[model samples]
Target: MTRSTDSWIQQLSTLMGDFYQLLAKMQYLDLDQGTIDYPPYIDPEKSVDTILATQLGINPEAIQLLQRLPYVAAPARWNHGAGDEEFVLYGCFADFRKDGELEESRDPLYASIDPKDESVGWEDEDGQYMRPWYVPLSRLGNHGVVLILNMKNRHLWVIDQEGGCSDPGLSDVDWNEDLVNKNSLDRYPSRPATEVLRDLMQKFISLEWIPGGIHHGYQHHHYKRLYLAHGWPDNFDSPAFNATRQVWEDEERAQYSAERPFQDVDRLELWTQLPTISSQLARCEAENASPAWHAQFQGGSGRIPYESRKAELLARLPGEQQRRQELLRELEQARRDVVGVSGEVRRRREERLRLDGR
Candidate 1:
């Protein structure tokens, strides 16, 4: 092996050791069956001597690096929330080889065209190059990031649906640092497979160490906040958390409905209920004068009664009607102004023509 290759192998070994230790500490191997005897290290160079070797034109160094890492068969349930699942890392590119040639069509990440077609490669609408050799490293349920390695440059990339293998601006020398700084939303380049695995293991450890908090709903903003607060949980399958989140979402929906009772009502439906709403609004306004009503509504700090909302709606109806009338009047005025201007222009043109004729 070249000096650089030797260095990479050594670094990979250290990272693998760290990752193995983390897995052991988390008792992941114990939790999952049939992975106990899985080899801890891979000899990427010699390991690719299989029948399919001739088909895959991948560098031996890349293969060796892939083999050095552990292949997770059954991913452990690390989280129990919706869309938050354990990260499963695996290496399997045999399907890419068919009839002793790279079958680009077999992989969804890559284009369906032939790999030998140098004129084209996988890319987004913006024409940014997406590395075709994306080996899925970890997944959060059905969705997750894939690790792509540039065999020639020996640079690693982490990509997903959100962002493909494109780094914002970071040097290759500090690749691991850049990866560590990346948030769950970011898709950027990182260190090789072993280092990336080690980083993921660290994140898993951090998440496991954090004591479970109040379940937040599964909105993007909520999820982003939670992810920032408590790194993405390795597993979100906690029945308790899931139940809590569901209840929270249900409450939110109910509260939204309570706040906007007329939101679902059509114009005809709203008109039909106006009389009743007006009567309720009057009653609510009258009740507002009483201390008991104030206490019941907690001085208007708590949820506003439906009666109060109805009253507000009734009050705003006339204003909305007046605003519509005002808009109609303005539109008529604008039409008149346009007509007058056109007539004036025509008269001036006629006068000028008459003067020229005279």
Candidate 2:
């Protein structure tokens, strides 16, 4: 940050950060992803931990909505796992919502393959829900930072863009001044809102937070943005604002200002039809695979009852029974997701499809 005789640059940046924080606090930012078309998504079923929410500076409401919008990723690029890493059955938590946190306050973020929660650990053969969401650590350009949270497992990861955790530059430090100079000896590191948020959030994970025990690198339960076979929601399109007009305080401000595009809220949608369709599709594969789970779909038994089916699974080895149990639990979770979508939402969906032939 160099001295511009005019102070508009600093002010404009503050205004951009404030606007996002405001929308989230107001709960007007729509985080819902849509449903009904092709590959479907379910609304978020679980709540993000309150303590975790406060620390990430993400609105808890936003997270609940985000969970509904799993990445529609098929065979998502995953590192750290072995054979079962190529996944199609489960969509992961494709991304986290902390970009705003970093810009507003320069927190020293770090990336890690390690997490404090023991349950948060994943094997190469593990399925989707067991993983957390991640954004690339390289996103931290000069000052770009991202915070990764595994709400399902209550595990947290901090990604420091610098990558040089030990040899950080003065450019990366926030020392209570607008411009942090590289060749000066003036101030100590100052605490920003993000730093405060980071410290208060460590203890709630599955294990106590200990920096020494964790590993480096990233992991995922990544889900890509899935489009519904049905189509986009009617209100998904929010009217664009005249950001330039709104934020420019004066001519000097106008010269230095550029729009800070905020994330639109239409990202979350949990309408009943989509998840039902998703379950049906997955169930179709499960049924087709039942006769051939061992050999990866040789024949088909067409989905059988739980008690009667266990005897039929191929390869009865040391972990066969446990694997079957996890699969059942995952299936049951999907079923619970579809159980109570409202009649009105269903009626509206029916009306829309009938009208549009979607």
Candidate 3:
């Protein structure tokens, strides 16, 4: 552990405690006495696995943990503090598989195949050679302030590590070519390594998985504490009632019944007009073999025998039949009117011929 970055590494060990505090606060979680005794952030004399099991509520034996390069930040260089300044930043690491395999090793080819490929012997090569990449966490330094985040959980870690203006060693200086190779920049994780570098750059300016720009929408959170506490970002101005209404309507008109029905009856209002009687008849005819379809349509107020349902549909058919007859009568009258008008025009033409003596 006598590496050039040993002190920085030790600083990381210390920093993990602070990072853990931030995560705990973000989740609104509390540590039990056992967890307090053995936390995951710091290296205890005992196995870290035992501690993770006690604290995180997961089987630590099953979980694989990897140490990422610690994020570091250099002091700000101030030549009298103008708008622009070069700040040296450090202390960023990524979590990945211990074996250098895909994040989702169970499914190496995660993305769907492209349908455009039409070669007779061609194989799906898009996700064929791809590896699964997931759940990136990043640490960043802007100017002199360091911002670190666990993207999946939306945890933010901040530390002001910048040395004061009096510290010259921490500020900008001539770099030795020898030292550059000795302590190279650590690599970040990406689907392709380039994307990882890009993400690392953007992490300082933005947080991932969060909606950007002026408008924001719903984001589902599984952790109850985080969901209930944060309540949705203020930028998400969409009314909850309206959003819920649309969801309900979508469920109602959906081809299949919703697996999980909305329990809030007051919120889920259906349209004033019920399913049309004709539509019901059509559905009945199409789904005659399906008992489930029969149960759905024939349930509740319309509970009756199949014969009775048929009779009810047949009972309404006569009214439609009567309307059809009325329409046919009107069509006949219109044709007669046209013939009478033609006869009158013929009579007028004959009168004109007689008057002209032709």
Off-target runs (Cα >4 Å) in candidate 2 are 1-21, 24-66, 69-143, 150-153, 163-247, 253-358
TM-scores of the candidates in the order shown: 0.39, 0.19, 0.24
Candidate lDDT (C-alpha), each: 0.42, 0.29, 0.31
Q: Which structure among the candidates has the greatest TM-score?
A: 1
Residues 123-161 of candidate 3: C-alpha lDDT, one tens digit per residue: 222222111111223222232323332222223222223
Writing each residue's lDDT as its tens digit, candidate 1 over 1-358 gives: 6888768766754664565445544433333443422343354332324334324444456545545544333333233322222332222212121232123212324423343456643332222242333333333223334455554555555555443443322234332333332322124445556555555555445542211111222343343344344323464333445455456557656654443322323333445455456556655665444645644656666466555654665576565555555555555554454444344444544443464453
What 10-residue stretch in candidate 2 is worst by lDDT?
Answer: 218-227
Tens-digit lDDT track of model 2 for 1-358: 2244123223322432343333222222223422111112232223223355445444443334332322221221122221111111111112223334222221223223223335532332221111222211112323333333333222223333443221122337544333233211122232232332334222212112111111122101000011011121222222222222133224323322211111011111223234445555555554554444623332443355543454433223324445545555555555555455455544544543464445
